[model samples]
Every structure is written in C-alpha cells, then in structure tokens.
Target: MHMTDVLAAADISKAVAAFAAADSFNHKQFFVMCGLKAKSKDDMKKVFHILDKDQSGFIEQEELCLILKGFTPEGRNLSDKETTALLAAGDKDGDGKIGIDEFVTLVSES
Candidate 1:
C-alpha cells in the first residue's frame, strides 16, 4: 500500500483552517523524518495517520506540531507561525490544514 492508498481512505478536499501549536519544519530534511521510514506510500500514510491526532481525517495545525516533534531530535513542536508555513507549503487547497493528498504528495515528491 502507498500513502495514496491510506489517504484515499479519507474524505478529499475538505477545507479546514487554523492549527494551534508552537516550533518549525526543516525543509532541509526529508518528510519521513517525521517518524516515517516511508520508502513506500503506505508507510507515508501511516505516518500521516499518526499525525492526525483528532482522527478528523485531517492533520490540523496543532497535530502538525506534534508531528514535527518526532522529526526533530529535541522532540519539540513547531512554532505557530512555522506550522502555518508547513501547512501552506503543501496545502494546495488553501484549507489551512494538510489533507491526505497534500501530505502524500509532499512526502512522495520529496
């Protein structure tokens, strides 16, 4: 399975705005640095699911900070401003949150 398969199980393109947390996503590193070995798409999705804390099928801003925690050695969350950029970096729909597709594509492409 791939990240696409995992995200495909979710609803597509639901507009959600705002995420709450404070840290940064280092563009220098790989997306799987977020606790995902993610050589395969399914692996990426698993990481996505792990980040989607509310289980709303969307990885909200707060959740994204938590995800960033794993990506860092200090296990620190992202700053709210930085988190917004992370969302914007891949939020193709401008929903303010990272949907499955956005996340999968972001990681897969990288």
Candidate 2:
C-alpha cells in the first residue's frame, strides 16, 4: 500500500499520544510490530519487497502469512488461533490480509 494509506487508516491523535509515551520509534519496532525485521534500510526494503509479493505494493493475506512465517523463528511460530486473532485485529479492511496501511494503523493503536 502507498504510505499515504497509513495516514488514512491511522488515528492521528492517538498515534501522537502514544508516540509521546515511547522512548523512541525505530525501524526495529516498526518491523517487529508489522511481523518483519531486517539489519539495515536496504534489508528492510528487501523484506518489504518480499512481503509485497505481487509487486502491487499492497500485501495480501497470503503474503502477510508468508511474511510472518519468514520472521517467526523456528519452534516459535504462533498458534493458528493466535495468528488468526492478530490478523483479525490488524486487517482493518476486513480483506483477510494486511497491507502496510492497516499494519501501521494497528501498531499506532497499540
């Protein structure tokens, strides 16, 4: 999804308030919350590209699942139910997948 989608989905007031309570916001937190990680900006872009499997710049349900699986360490995978709930909570569009917009919105709420 386009970065503008994030602003559209987010509660700006809430995000600003939450931002105040944090020590800082960083790539690590952004990735972890979105169920991703990378060692550098380039690496992070790689992860984003992988998640955007269709090159549509929007991550569909299947891609979201794949991305989460890629990040989850061996033997530490989330239970089916847990994963389901997470998706349910974050998939704001009710489209069964989470685009970057939805992910940013969800994390901002948290």
Candidate 3:
C-alpha cells in the first residue's frame, strides 16, 4: 500500500481498538475516532456508502455486525446485541435496515 493508505489503516486500527473497549456503543464518538466526523451532509453520505458494504443503499444488520472490519481486516465483529441496538438507532422508519438519509441524520444529530 501507499504510505498514506498504510497510515490511514493504522489510524483506523487504533480507533477500532478504542471503540471495542467502550462500555457502550456511541456512534458519534466512534465516527469521530475513525476520523469520520462529517462537516457536511455530503461527507456523511460518503461514510454511509462505505458502511453499506453491499451497495444496497442501506445498512443491514449483517453489515453493521461486521462494521469494524470495514476499517481493518483484523477488526472484531460487533456482538449481536450491539448490532441490533445500532440498527434500531439508525433504522428510524421501522425498517430493518438503515437507509442513507437515516444514516446521515443519525450521525449528524448525535
């Protein structure tokens, strides 16, 4: 990988490690740790796209469960309970998954 890619990967690994030790899942703090504190709706949308691994325009529970792995190959998977809670928080429309708009709002407001 390029130097910048390697550096970013290292940063993400540290962030993921810190997040894994937190008592509760705090989406806003997690995002900030990952250097994903969006300065605009468009920036937030990009982050949502990254998390939406299937490119289905939504973040399913399965995707959320493995969200940390998106940052680094060694990142641990989120527990079932954590995944469900995160889904419920972002799935504002009672949908089983988080759409782009919901994702943006969830991160922006938190």
Candidate 4:
C-alpha cells in the first residue's frame, strides 16, 4: 500500500497547518490527526516500509529528517532537534537507527 492510500492530501495539509500553528513537532498529535493512531500493526509496518526510503531495513537520522516529506510533497523537513528526539525514541537498541520492530513499537506506544 502507498502512503497516499493511507493519508490523503487533505490530511497532510491539516497536519502541516497544525505544525505551523504550533511551531513545533508533536509526534503523537500528528499521528492522531493523520489517523495513524488507529492504523493496524500491519498498516504501520507498511508505513515503516514507505518511510525506509533507501530500503535499508531501518530508518536512519538523515531519513528521519525528511520523514514528513514521505507523507506529502509539501511536508517540511523535521528540525534537527525533532529528528534527534524521534530517532532517540525509536532507536531502542541504541544502534542509532530505527529497525522495523522498534519503529512499530514506538508508533504503537505513542
């Protein structure tokens, strides 16, 4: 499944507006607003795959910086601090990248 199939353009716009208004990246709120919180584990895996742009089997910090763009063309890049926080949250094994299982767990728990 493709990202556009999961999150529509309207949803991406709404998320962008919210982020602009707040001037900060709220991971949980963004997920909730984008309907990601209700997605099944399998769906989340699909999302992880989509985000893993290099097919590296993991999401590295550099990719995390551009993660929002994976959702939409107009989505902004994450700030360095936001990227670091997100990576720290999901890189549970301390390998400095987020593996599939860790990605699922991080999103699920959020």
- The model with the greatest TM-score is 4
Question: Each model's TM-score?
Answer: 0.65, 0.43, 0.80, 0.90
How many clashing pairs does model 3 include? Answer: 0
- Once all C-alphas are superposed, what RMSD does model 2 give against the true structure? 11.6
Models ranked on TM-score: 4, 3, 1, 2
lDDT, residue 89, candidate 4: 84
What range of 10 consecutive residues in model 1 has the weakest lDDT sum? 11-20
The C-alpha lDDT values of all candidates are 0.56, 0.46, 0.74, 0.82
Candidate 4 segments exceeding 4 Å error? 21-23
**Candidate 1 runs further than 4 Å off:** 1-24, 32-38, 70-74
Tell me which of candidates 3 and 4 scores higher on TM-score.
4
**Which scores better on TM-score, 2 or 3?**
3
Choose 1 or 3, whichever is better by lDDT. 3
Name the 10 consecutive residues with the lowest summed lDDT in model 3. Answer: 1-10
Q: For residue 43, what is the lDDT in candidate 1? A: 65
lDDT of candidate 1 over 1-110, digit per residue (tens): 23334433121111011112133245324343322334576766676776676778888777876653433223456677676767777688987788887888877665
- Cα lDDT tens digits, model 2, 1-110, are 43222322233233233323223333224444443331334444555555576877666655544443333222123345545656787778787777666655554455
Error of 1 at 56 (Å): 0.8
Pairs clashing within candidate 4: none
